[model samples]
Target: MVVQESGTPRELEHHLRPSTVKGIDFDQLLEPLAATAHGAANKRPITGVSLNPQIVQPGDVFLAISGAKRHGAEFLDTAIANGAVALITDEAGLNLLAEPASIPVAVVSDVRKIAARAASMVYGTAKNCPELLAVTGTNGKTTTTFMIRAITEALGLHAGLVGTIEMSARGQIIPSVLTTPEATQLHGVLARMNEQEISTVAMEVSSHSLSYGRVDGLQFAVSGYTNLTQDHLDLHGSMEDYFQTKAQLFTSGHSQRAVVMVDDSYGQRLAQNASIPTESLSLDAHTNADWHVVNIAPSVLGHQFTIVHRDGREIHARTGLPGLFNVANAALATVMVLASGVALEQLQEALKQADPLSVSVPGRMQVIGESPVAVVDFAHNSDAIAKALESMRVTGQGRRIIVFGATGDRDKTKRPDMGAVAARHADIVIVTDDDPHGEDPEPIREQVAAGAQAVIDAERAAVQLFNIAPRAKAVEFAVSLAGVQDAILVAGRGHEVSQDVAGIDVELDDRVELANALKLHGFVTIY
Candidate 1:
């Protein structure tokens, strides 16, 4: 007998305001948008928002946003031909002459920002369904968001995930390029989740997304802070600016609560200054933290720990994820899950029934070998590099070598910092290429080399440092240097299957290459 797949009923179309010939006062909203558009109009009218030309129905407003290498407004004619009732754009877009059309064009200043606000107004329905919880930090945002989704699902609620890895709404997974999607796409996803009865949204709010106004009008019920480290400086200009951008989600608009992990200085600062009530978490750190992790021990499998919430309430838990730092990340996730109204009993039961959470966090201290242990991680910053190295040093009984590189066109200031951390922590260090996009590989390597050299010159540190570019070669060399008892940690790229060079993505899996390099050296594993 044939079986049919189960599916939900289709939802109705989105709500759109009717268009009227009598122009309305575009005064309150578009004044800033109009000034940026260089268009003077107090009575300009707009009907609806439409980004896609092919799907644009009659009496809809067509928007043209500037893309990486092109402008979205270039497709204005296509949108019009497809039945756009009104045009929403800046002066450059309005100036594009087309045959006399019957539609009215509403010119706004700061088109991107205005479009975001407009889209949220048009499509945002977070209030009608489950509360939206926004998670923002330099690190742990992805893991925390996914963990919250797990806990929410354990409580039998439909939870949606939006982050760097992928998006999950009502059991459908879609790949994403940006950590936080464009306002139009984000609102559209949330609206679909709302329709599908997925009440809770756990989203990663990136610094770039916050500064660019991607989540302009999102009404987050609670916002969590994991911690801040040196990252994304190329976009934010300074660490202060980057922290301020991340803080926007916790303090801005309609965020009601701030769940912060105060182990980092920035997290503590955010909690102290938060407008809303804040819950703080720390792992053996001396702080007036509201939530804390204690009784920690590491096993070959993972770490076990107990989390103490406010009022001395404690839950014994063990995560399959590795390292002590991850325990802190788990604590942040746990606190947020509890704050989401999941009962303590449900949280404890879910922790027990769910698959061990360790070895599940991607590129996070993932071990691939035993004798000559090979680990892969996405630790690109100084603190993260330090944590990964420390974890390896303690976990590995013998020599520990680290292979890593600083990413090009991104926070170059951290190159030396990362090098210093690696050199000081590991027994051997290999500085290699990491996405030297559009930058000279030698200079990038030289910067990291200087950092390692600085650490070596200052003190005869544990790690012997070397530099090699064209990342694959460095990995090959690092593997060759390893012995039976030595571990080689390939850092910076973890579970990343591609290498980006001068703006081109090339297939390069560090883990696979590491294994191949081991095979070339006649090292075979018996599991």
Candidate 2:
């Protein structure tokens, strides 16, 4: 039974974004798993696939897989109630079900492996698209993916993008919840990309997505490894596990080839052990790599560097994104484009002429002002915050004022570390909220402030502490403190449009608020 509601074409697209397929035999679909389909609704024709119970429709199959915090078996009843034609789940979920289920069930030993395959069959295979480029790492995944899309577009090719900030195919873009989308949405986005005539796609593949089976069955044309760092320990438990999860992208069946940045020890290990053919990349010109950035110039406008190729040829490249880290990001993107089979001469020339603003990632080191310089960056972790502050410190001959906060319900250990980093690098540190999620904002701020207070006696001294509840007020407070030659750093929640207060994402854009503050302070007239 199809439920049709009258609406505009745009409304219809949002509702029916996931393409539906039918006429496939329900039991036959489970042949891939060798599981017997049993229930009152065994022979129903499947029309679509879904993971979330609320989104399941008539003739849709639900995959009840385990998660980091909870088991999907708990939601079996919800899924069945939401018109799930059948359930494709592990033995644990099967045990949760009674002997006679309201719907058919496909019991599998590994639900992750089949979930994406089933999604692909219902919508379409994303592999049929022209090219799929996946970039994975702790940082720079979003920036690099945007770069790939920009470079491809400059070369007169239509490109699609999927990453931390948003998902875009053609001209349409939507804010992203995960660095990599869920398996169902990932395949659906790929299908939409093909429909929109997007020739090339660059996506971010996060460790959580890889570990949680969110990107189970998708293959990439070429995967680029950005440097991994110490983060996400609450989920991965250890740095070794984090590195291994990232390495999955470079394995035999995942990517065709790899462009590994050997700037860090982990990258060195990944390049050496990559199952597929790999090319080593480096930001340090002296480091031996197939591609390296030498003769670098870092400015307020970003870095201008010459990329030395394997043949000793140099490509003069410049990105307006700023910082030395961005040079590495641009270089990695250059190699990824090369791995995609774009002609070397074309890529080199295009890179030399690449407009930084065209590929500018929204919140990663975005400068919103000129005089009394202010910057907004998504430097949530300790290392990232330190790097952002240091980058600004090196560039400006001024006092650095920092406004940032720790995300609630995340790695609690990094709280003090972030505080220590801010206290060490920033002249003035203002602690505020960054996505409190389900945790109390006050306690989260205290942990970060405690860390900062331990390292430096800023509370009683020059470093200012403001217990601002609302994020916009924090930005206003930081702006108020800005004097001549003083550069302010707004860390955490870069390019993010909402602040996760309590449980809901209240509309709060850093750039929007920062730009407003800059304008009020008479820093920039045109936002």
Candidate 3:
């Protein structure tokens, strides 16, 4: 049920012109090239895309983006060596391109959106795609995006997904490195999806992508919001800034119908303020939303819930996933399908009988094999941490041993808050490492320790507190401390396979370590 629009085909070649580059666009939007001028080829029509220079094929465009710690364009020589035809860059990369290379260099006004639009045009825009739905918010965005993709495919639609965990089509698997990719990469992905005859795409829309113009130019048939929380304060500067970025997806005129979860105030505000007609969902009764969940019940098996639309349409839904939070996620997915014009009866059947999706959303809430339920979840922010800890507490039959760490260089303010929550909730607190980046491990440990200490009674603080600066060592020590009757929670580095220490990514996984530790302790159970 895509909203039919009368328009010309959106073209990539049409938007890649040199005349439209803006400074702010260059600073915030464009992806800087990873290639250096040392080996750049002559400017030509790019038929392919690559971030890495070595893998760049001839006649392909090389995108140089400034990443979390370094500029991507610093690898221009490598890009040129592999046969890059053109370059999309920002002002800073001009110095690198001082001497002309073989390729045509186009300075973009805003790299993010421009690149996305360019890729769409080159790869084939919304016209080529069956339909596109972008899911945005602070938490559960990745899960909801994947859920929608799963439901779509389950209903016999060929679906493609792009989110934090991975990217996939009917038959190929590509590991996901970013929650949302750059404009060119995104467009290229859609292009590939079009080639695969994928009728739909469900993707996560990060605040960074919206603010940086990473998702510009393409129109979304249905765009949905999960919930906003206290994450990414380091980049957005404040909660208001974060909300504004998320709001852009609904209001920036890219989406047709907005599906928002009005469980929180932010979602309520978005529903009331959005330009398009919004489908609002609620986990609790306060929202009085367009799409509402009633008779909600949670159990160890999963969630049994009912969805009520404003027109008296009802859907009795169930999901294998646990927690009340996931109900909101499921409801959001249901509404996205409804918004896309799937029949209510179909939505109900899909909800009730959809096969248990084999999605390994790395850190969402990964269960480590053992009794007492050792779990690893990617709950770094205060809101997510609180939710993860509480979910673990409610689901388990024994005392909880929570192990976590705050990143070294991120929003330092959240450290104490996270510590306070962990201290008040968990029976045991094992403070550990999570991507210290350039910051010293000790200070990060101290900050989290300070947080936990602030909430704990002074008399018991010393006994409950333990610090292990390196993540693997911290996990090892924590795992050793747990017994079969106690649940050990390894939070923060949920699905990640590496730890960034002193600028190098070192291998580490909570699941792998926990498995070995369980086997080492000589615990055997087929269950």
Task: Indicate which candidate wins on lDDT.
Answer: 2
Indicate whether candidate 1 or candidate 3 has the larger TM-score: 1
For residues 62-84, write the lDDT of model 2, one tens digit per residue.
88887777767678777777677
> How would the candidate models be sorted by lDDT, starting from the highest?
2, 1, 3
Please identify model 1 stretches exceeding 4 Å from their true place: 1-60, 66-71, 78-85, 96-103, 124-126, 393-397, 522-527
Each model's lDDT: 0.72, 0.79, 0.72
Which residue pairs collide in model 2, if any?
302-322
Q: What TM-score number comes out for model 3?
A: 0.84
lDDT of 1 at 293: 89
lDDT of 2: 0.79
Clash list (residue pairs), candidate 1 = 33-108, 33-109, 34-109, 37-109, 130-199, 320-358, 321-358
Q: After superposition, how far is residue 509 of candidate 1 from its true place, in Å?
A: 2.0
Error of 1 at 240 (Å): 1.7
Each candidate structure's TM-score, on Cα atoms with residue i matched to residue i, is 0.85, 0.89, 0.84
- Between prediction 1 and prediction 3, the one with superior lDDT is 1
| Per-residue lDDT of candidate 1, residues 1-527 (tens digit) | 21222222111113211212222334443454553423344333443456666556554566776668766677777777866655677666666645433455566655777766665555544344357888888777777787778767766778888888677776666655688876766776677677777878889999888888888767787888877888888888888988888877777575878788888789889988887878888885477898888888875646888888769788777776666777777777778877767778878888777732442555666666666877788887888888876766433367778899988877788888888888888878899998888888788888988988988988755558888867888888988988877877899877688988988999998878887888878776421
